[model samples]
Target: EELNMDLFSNCMDTVERCLRDAKMDKSSVHDIVLVGGSTRILKVQQLLKDLFNGKELCKSINPDEAVAYGAA
Candidate 1:
């Protein structure tokens, strides 16, 4: 739980920074696509759900294959 909390803080900070840098509001985001295995954590998913006001996350791409799919 402690680790998840820390990770959640970092994730929140990063997301906020990205949105701020892009001059976009969280409401302007249509989808929240999570990449990487770490995102499989339930706490991480919950944090994102809460952050996006219960927006459903896009999980069409396999987390393990997302990097390679993007590179391709």
Candidate 2:
């Protein structure tokens, strides 16, 4: 749990920075498309849910294949 908390903090920072750079608010985000293996972590998923106020994450694309899919 401690490790998860640390990761969550970092994720929060990154999200905040990205939102600020985009000049958008959390409410403006429609979907959270998680990519990469770390995103599959349950703790990460829970943290994101909390961050987004219970918004359902878009998991239609396989996390592992997201990069390849994007390149194609």
Candidate 3:
């Protein structure tokens, strides 16, 4: 729970910052990408969507296991 809360808090803070800088609301957010394995957690993904107001954050790319695959 602690981890989830932390991730959610940080993600929301970052999103708020970006939105402020870009003069955008959640609707203006083009894409929300997760760059690490920790993103695989359901809590993380759900929190992301919730924070963005059900914007359906993009996960077309890998969130947890794409780096090593490309590092090769």
Candidate 4:
């Protein structure tokens, strides 16, 4: 599988815009609950942390199962 940096950048950019729109500072974001299959990839996690200034990211839940659990 190929990793698309452009797509990853766009995703990170979107997330940053959302956080900004919500008037939420990244410093206050303790947990980055990424509930998508793509987030299972390391690049996504690294990008998120980089964008959020190295804030701790939590990904303990099983990626495949967690989304289903949250959706229910």
List TM-scores for all candidates, in order.
Answer: 0.86, 0.87, 0.62, 0.78
lDDT score, residue 21, model 1?
98
Candidate 1 lDDT, tens digit per residue, 1-72? 885687689988898899999999999999888899988888888888898899999889888998898899
Candidate 2, residue 70: lDDT: 86
Higher lDDT: candidate 2 or 4? 2
lDDT of each: 0.88, 0.89, 0.76, 0.81
lDDT of 2 by residue, 5-25 (tens): 876789878988999999999
Query: Least accurate stretch of 10 residues (summed lDDT) in model 2?
Result: 3-12
Backbone Cα, N, C clashes tallied per candidate: 0, 0, 1, 0
Q: Write the per-residue lDDT of candidate 4 for residues 42-62, one digit (tens) a residue.
A: 888888888888876777877
Better of 2 and 3 by lDDT: 2
Model 3 / residue 1 / CA error / Å: 1.2
TM-score order of candidates, top first: 2, 1, 4, 3
* Model number with the top lDDT: 2
Q: What C-alpha lDDT, on a 0 to 100 scale, does residue 43 get in candidate 1?
A: 85
Q: List residue ranges in candidate 3 displaced over 4 A.
A: 64-72
Error of 4 at 45 (Å): 1.0
